[model samples]
Target: MDEVEVVVAHSQRATLRVGEVFLKVDVDPAHADVEVRAMAMVPVPTPAVLWCEPPVLAIAAVPGTALGVLGAPSPASPAAWAAAGAAIRRLHDAPLPPWPGRKLDDVAEELDRECAWLLANDVLPAEVVRRNREIAEAVLRPWTPAFIHGDLQITHVFVDDEDRVTGIIDWSEAAPGDAMFDLAILTLGHEEHLDDLLVGYGDADRDVIRAWWSLRSLTASHWLIEHGFDPDEPGCEFDVLRARMPDS
Candidate 1:
């Protein structure tokens, strides 16, 4: 067999690797205001350290699984979040530490700043950002702080024929904070998953989920404007993320 180096680009960054094991790196050109912060690993129970040195890095054991989407979502409809909530729940269950990552105030502040920046850039209006800031602050306030698989979208699931999650990757944004934020990410991205993972989460009011989902959407929309991309024609799912946020 022959090996060639290829560059794989995700929403926030690109990965360059070759051969059986490919190293995927996520780069967010603008760190000041980002939605998901480019995940190198998904939300799963897999135990591994998620870190990056200016540029993101992920050394995968799979032959070419490190490639873009790793052939996820098949030939079409790759938008559906293939990652399972149960897997994310397990990730949340992982015994972690309450260091800076777990600080509730920090999370809230970051969301507020992103929203503020987006509003300033004309990506989002003043009223929308203000409302979103309120919602974000509320969600992060008084939270017990559970492990959040930062970027919980369809491709993260990594499933099989039975629809069972085989593995979860993209943990770069993984942090200890409000679980609602992560839950919102899953629900908003995968409508079908909302019900699928209800059992895994044990049970929660639908209204509660809505608030978090809305907050997540509002916070994520900034990624486009921050990158100087046209928010109207983002040409990707983040636009849907922006649309799903709804008006205040």
Candidate 2:
């Protein structure tokens, strides 16, 4: 019998690994549907779907280790990061998904609500929240939308020993959105690798990427806490906010 390894679990979803296969269980079947559709459409490497039955989607594990995890140093080489960036570039160049992404006004409204919640809850210093919120405003402007892995966290990217990208996982959040937003998510809390990534992704607006870092961190902190994740961990969202402080 294969031993079960719990990858992640929250009220909304959970992932478990059993040897070479991963089983993702979601509260909403629509999320699995989106993942299946998005994976099939992407130009980059992705895990193979073995089967899907409502809330449970089974996939064969891809080769290579994850690019990195939040709150920890990544052992992947600069070339590996660059390769991941190139893969992302390919995805961005692909045709937009049929569905529409969040409107800019919706994003701004959500940011406002989240910021207000952060302030009302006293999750961080008011100054930290204020500064990051100010920084977050830069990403609120309009831009050409591209197919984006909406939750392109570092852990979603995989690379092999020779510094080549192997696969990207977790497509539930994939959609049409700001390309810089995906870049920002990929480098969140690992800002040192941004230059290496840009080597493969081509030039982009660094300020907008930075703005997304702030916006994403601010909007995500509350949900992370509620989901039983610790965003305050070193090199994580809280630190990302603190680093934006003038004195830091």
Candidate 3:
């Protein structure tokens, strides 16, 4: 019998792996609903749904290894990254999902609230937080929404040995959103691959992409800490924020 492996566990949700199947248990069924719907609608490859039962969703694991992981250099070839970019482009070009994404105003409010919390808790150096906040301002403007993967972290992408993108996983955050935001998340800790990704994704606003990097890192730090994640690990969220400093 295959041993059960805890993929991830936290206050809100937990994922477990048994042999070839993964079971995701969430506190809210809505997230799983969205994930199931998004996976069904996305043009890109996704994990196959084995079954659905409210809080728990079972899915067959996709082939290939994750594209990369945060805080570490990706061993994937540039071609693999480009293929992932191409896949993302297809997703973005697809028709919009039925649901509207977070409004610009709401995003700004969250950014402000998270920044304030960071300062109040001294979670990051004042200067670091302030500078990143400034950089984050660029993303406040409106964007033509795309069918986005929303949380397209590196770990969500997978590629075969030949460097072809095989599949992407984790669709709970999927929605209509800024395409650049997804691009930014994919390359969060792997900035060196931006050029490679854009090669297949086509041109993008570099400034907006950079801004989302700051915004995402800032907003996510607090939640990561609360959820028992170390955003300060080398080459993670904290490093991404620090990179915005002039001297960094």
Q: In candidate 2, where is summed lDDT lowest over 10 consecutive residues? A: 76-85
* Model 1 error, position 160 (Å): 0.6
Candidate 1 ranges beyond 4 A from true positions: 1-13, 17-20, 26-58, 61-83, 125-127, 228-248
Q: Give per-residue CA lDDT, model 2, range 82-102, as digits (tens).
A: 898899999999999998788
Clashing pairs in 3: none
RMSD of each: 6.7, 0.6, 0.7
- Report how far off residue 191 is in candidate 2 (Å): 0.2
Off by over 4 Å in 3: none
Which 10 successive residues of model 1 have the least lDDT summed?
63-72
lDDT by residue (tens digit), candidate 3, 99-193: 87889999999999999999999999999999999999999998999999988999999999998888899999988999999999999989999
Error of 2 at 93 (Å): 0.5
Candidate 2 shows a clash count of: 0
Q: Per-prediction TM-score, please? A: 0.64, 0.99, 0.99
**Per-residue lDDT of candidate 1, residues 90-177 (tens digit):** 6667665333354656656767777677767776557655654555445654766676767665445555545555555555566666
